[model samples]
Target: MPVLVATVIGLTLIGTTARDVVSVNPEIATAATVFCGIFVQALPFLVLGVVVSGAVATFVTPDRLARWLPRRPATAILTAGVGGATLPGCECGSVPIARRLFGDGTVGAAALTFMLAAPAINPVVLIATAVAFPGEPLMVLARCIASLLTAISMGALWAKFGQPRWITRNLLRPTQQQDSRFSTFTEAARHDFLQAASFLVVGAAAAAALHVLVPSWMFDHLAGQLLLGILVLAALAVVLALCSEADAFVAASLSMLPLVPRLVFLVVGPAIDIKLFAMQAGMFGRAFAIRFAPATLVVATTVATGVGLLILGAR
Candidate 1:
């Protein structure tokens, strides 16, 4: 399916008829190309994410994760932030995994940290970011640092103020299907890919439409107004609900926006997109999602802005 999609995109981009269409009705052609480009570019990483998510489901249980963490809240939070690299799935898959990992005290905090961090800072996502912006190694670094900090900050906040009552249950209640490991892996991978890919299609379409409709002058204005740019991009991120694995390419495609706003988009999208909000609501309960999702958006935006200033420096 991905290959077929890629082939179609290639034909549209390079074929003479496509060029004629672009010249005749540029906006529609441009939007189509942008949408296809983002989707095709992101497909491989999305596949990789689903595969890794399946492996996580098959091999890594909540009990094993809990056993690995330190007892101290701060240390456990830090550990979980770093350990997020181990789960290379998108935010969709991480929600349920985090649900399984959620518990009392330090472990619960770590679970939340892992949920926020895994989607943004994992190896596959960082690699995709690097690929999307080949000239900007600092973008990858900034994303990693900013995402980690956001995760840890949220974890710390939860440690200090989070009520067990906010969650559906204080104890983790993981799936108990009596299935073979291969069966589990296949089922997990298939489900995640379908759900995540559907959301990715929506994001790509939104990005493509906005690319054509939003004027270049507005982007320049936002670039000049840093705070406004941050807020706008952050809001767009949530509304677009892009998959973590694919968001970098979409950010890269928005050439009019400067790196800082784009960075905010990348960070915020993975941490607290609309789909993630829905997933959190379904998995962790509405009470938890309402508080946690909003906080995550703020923290992710702030941390990404800070990191971008320090690292990318409005460039």
Candidate 2:
């Protein structure tokens, strides 16, 4: 294929360029490692998500998911938020699944809730938060409550105001003619992987550049300023585009800031970030992603701040 040939040529050029660049600027080498690390850490989850989403596309009808959920819209959204706990994976896998589940009307809200909640409220993420902030279990509790609240709020918003037109018709459409179920699943998985993974490369490149360019002194100056700290860390979370399973460790490493910003980091990273935005744009559409991502960011940050002050302050 043309893409395959172009990629091979690009990589060959990069292999030659990397040797020269590393000799000139060592930071480029370090950034490359971080770039590769992000992709390597995310690929398995991406594959899992595509497979899960493919299965959902092939087997789970809209009526089936609708039947499984509560009849009331608000209850269904909340249930979906809670249901996110069942899927133990990072944000990378949740996007495609969300797209697959997004049917017309209220069911779309539940799917979106699950997309946001699964990465943040899942046991693996909570355990990582606990380990990251030892003796401060409040951090874990705050993260869960804040992330769940954000998911629920977004679901509610979508139920009230969402225009299905924002999402591409391709997302809601299934293949009319079925081959074998296995064949359908494989085709869906392969298509999703290619789309999601290609965008992930863009996100990973942005993250690597930000990782290298962000000055360490910036954190030193953020002490005692809660609002500024929250904003900066939220922005950093978006830029770093870290895997939800691992972002807590990175947040913990930033001991310079207060618990609130770190809490904001955990809350915002899983809910809205560069990588998730890219995936959403690919799966849904640019219109949906642009509106949804900023809303999620504001909700996550606000909810995390409120929860952090309550739980962490009480302790």
Candidate 3:
């Protein structure tokens, strides 16, 4: 599927270039320049996520995690949600870690919750939000509340209606063992890095194209209607698929949009996006990814809007 998508994109670029649809040197050159920077910025975090995910997968025994976790479901969910703050990497990195946890026999719903919450609610993201919103601490609070609420809500929904059997059979297959934990960890890390780095390349190319082709005036036209702006930003989040570490900076640069809409950008981004959807589709079954991704989109957008308006007043 990724190959097909990439082929389509390449063909489109070729067609456009041949037809002079976009400026010859300027557009391609601009895209190349922007993508180079974006790729460099995102690669390190991708590497970090893969390493941590691999380590967790290869070395961290399920028994160890289970022993440390609270026995109660609610406690476990809340702990996982709040524990997102401690994870140092962005949303892109969280996917592999969450998958590793599930594969290693950690709770599926709980791991999913952590995947969504941790990137957005973590200290790195929070600090980025704080910097982005500067004097408006409420923006940071709204982002946190929205992230937690969305994660918890999705978790509860999965608990009630999700087919654990599907997860068990398709998504969380156990990793093969090796004689040495150190060697296993290194191997897993290398595998994860390659996988994530490839996806990051795809995402960066898309983001750079959008940056070059989409006019800044586009956002300006949608500024006044708060709900509309939030919806638009939510869609943009899916398309941009920016790293959580840098998304706030992007949001900050979009000074045309109001605080509430930008807040939605931060809240919904880590939970759902095109690159993430692609990654999830690969890791989980296609049917499962389809349902889960949309579910998260609806929930995250709704929660973000509600929290944003409640905290910051209706824009």
Candidate 4:
């Protein structure tokens, strides 16, 4: 209700002020449109993410998942990374599920893999990538492969050298120990959906604002420069903090950079971004999120660069 009222007042002010001004205030108009568009675009995804996340939290038990997996960390991580292909939601929804998995004693490599893969390799993200880069089946394939490799590699690295102390201290608690009425699938699903959706809305709104306010020419300076383009896009991804589901659309629209650079945009988004980092820090602890986010960023950028080169050569 407040948002609606604000929108009406804003529009009225803009309408009234336009006539009096010698020239229209493009910046103000652009800012308002961008802000509103972002809110609208992100609401649905945010709602969906929260519902799914809440459901997973409520229904899926730590013990149940543990029984379904092997004791080996490597095997568990592989399974978790690939399992993302089966999940339906975007990156925003994955954080809660990953946290839940960690809480359920599915920590270490497996939990990290789930965090990366669930957002990047999920069915929804893949389909969106395919649609975004038409006539380029390879783009989707590369994205999936790059994302999976990055997740798996990072998981393995963490398992080998990472100190247990660095892992999210909060997840050290036993999730199975918690008592809740979320035993039923319906209850778990509902809870997961709501939790994930709230974050998704926040992310999508930010991304939409970037889409409207940031001009395409801003990227023109980096066109055809892969390294600079990667850095710039990665920086933008951090600032925009867009959900994995909708980021491809924004990337596709950029059209200013080369295909490889655009690929980097999608790859870097899920693993490390400002919003995700903030959420992770808050939920997992500052120390854990800080280390994990930077590590993921470096690994994702390297893998994405390799994939980009491969695709460019093949073409």
Candidate 5:
């Protein structure tokens, strides 16, 4: 609520006739269109995520998760990735869910893997990708494979090198331990939506500003340079902080760029963004987020680029 009020105030301060100015300026009009398109397209999915995440809080227990995953780290990571593909929601909900599922040793790795994988490769995101890139099936496959690998790799790395002490916050707390199931459901949904909405507005504003400010030639330059394109798009994903369900459309909007770079954008957005970083720092700890977020970005970008090369080629 505060975020929204501040944004409204900021806009009003820009000018009382801001809408009139925007309508007259071609570049500003274009940016406004893109922002509206992304926000409107993503809003339904965001709501759905809130509802599903609430349900996840209500029903998905640590004991149930333990039963589902294998004991060994390798197998558990794999299983967690597959399991994540089943859950259809956004990254915000996954944070607390991951907190609930967090455990020692191998299980801890599995929970983190599930957190990364669920948002990027889940059925909802996959379908959205396919819809966004109707004629390109390889794009869908590349995103799925790359996102899955990123999750699994992170899990393996954490299992091998991550220290529990780094997680300075209460990384493991039963979300519904003290509350009734119905209260938990409503509260979880409300909290997730409130947390996500403010970030969504900020992200959309950044995207809109970039759309208007970036030189037209800049996008043209990205088209020919494959590696640079990949890196730029991945970084854009972090900057935009778009919802997983809506990023594909944003990527698709950049029809000027090659499919591989757009794939990197899709793969990286849900994995690590400003909002996710904030959520991680708030939910887990700054100590954990500072280390984990950067690592995930590198891993996601590298994995996405590699998979894109293999599956979609440098084209």
Candidate 6:
């Protein structure tokens, strides 16, 4: 029956004109392309993340991670934010790595910090920001400062109010397991990819829909107002669900908006967007994401606004 259906579908495709269908409703085709682009772009990074996560599961223990970090949560969170530069990937990659590194107490806080900071502060993203806003070196600086501040704030907040019970997913445990090392690695990677990828599809679809639905005139009008621009762009960041590595260009394209609001968009997108929110909610829990995401948006926006004013001189 499946084979017959497949054959019929293949015949129908051969008989039908795809171009005519697209000509009738281009939005559907455009949305599909956008969705695929997002999914494809994140695939490599997601794979790398899960592989690293698997390696951590197989080799690195919580006690080892705990011993490597500072004794105090505050200090460790700061350190993690700084150390985020070492990971050369986007937010999609950091989620699994952070999950692998997450532990009880200070380690968890540090891991959360690293997760928020890594994609935003990494050299690739910084260079992209610099390139996007040429002659505006301060934009790059503002982005770095705001992103680090946001990351550190979230880490500190998590240390104070985040409860482990809120996280539904647990890190893979190598001990008390019967599987071979290679098998364990493969399993972990497979599980992380499937889970993250599924939610990623949902986010990508939503983003594509927004791209098609929202009018360009709406942005032009909103960009004229300072507070409204910042808030709208911040919300746009969440809605667009752009990859951190590429978001600078997207923010830069919003030339109608002032530097400060665009800066807020860049800062807010990587720290907490639709895609990252979905991934975090899956890895953490709805309870945690509900609290954490809003706080991140607030902190990121405030920090970006302040840093932008100081650096860009009210521009």
Best by TM-score: 1
The number of the candidate with the highest lDDT is: 1
Candidate 3 local lDDT, 82-107, one digit each (tens): 77766544565567667756632227
Q: Candidate 6, which segments miss by more than 4 Å at Cα?
A: 1-66, 174-220
lDDT tens digits, residue span 134-229, model 6: 878988888999899889988998898889887776656567667888997777666655655555565567656756786878766775677888
Clashes of 5: 0
Q: Which one wins by lDDT: 1 or 3?
A: 1
lDDT of 2 by residue, 9-37 (tens): 99897997768877688788877876777
Residue lDDT tens for model 5, 1-315: 677689789988987588889878998898888878767876676677778777876887756877899998899999998889887657877777787778788988998999999888877788878877889999999999999999999999999988888877774444656788999889888887776665666666666776789787987888888889998888889987877876776787777789888888999998999889998898778988999999999999999888998999887
| TM-score of candidate 6 relative to the true fold | 0.69
lDDT sort, best first: 1, 5, 2, 6, 3, 4
Prediction 5 TM-score vs. true? 0.86
For model 4, the superposed segments whose C-alpha errors exceed 4 Å read 1-58, 89-93, 103-107, 171-218, 312-315
Model 2 spans > 4 angstroms off: 1-64, 172-217
lDDT of each: 0.88, 0.79, 0.72, 0.69, 0.83, 0.76
The model with the greater TM-score, 3 or 6, is: 3
Worst 10 residues of 4 by lDDT: 191-200
In candidate 6, clashing pairs total 0
RMSD of 5: 3.3
Clashing pairs for model 2 are: none
lDDT of 4 at 280: 83
| Better structure of 1 and 3 per TM-score | 1
Q: Could you tell me how far off, in angstroms, the CA of residue 118 lies in candidate 3 after the best superposition? A: 1.6
Per residue, candidate 1 scores C-alpha lDDT tens digits across 246-291 of 8899899987778999999999998998888888888878899999
- Candidate 4 on 196-270: residue-level lDDT in tens? 444445554554455566676766667746688888877777766766766676676566577777788889988
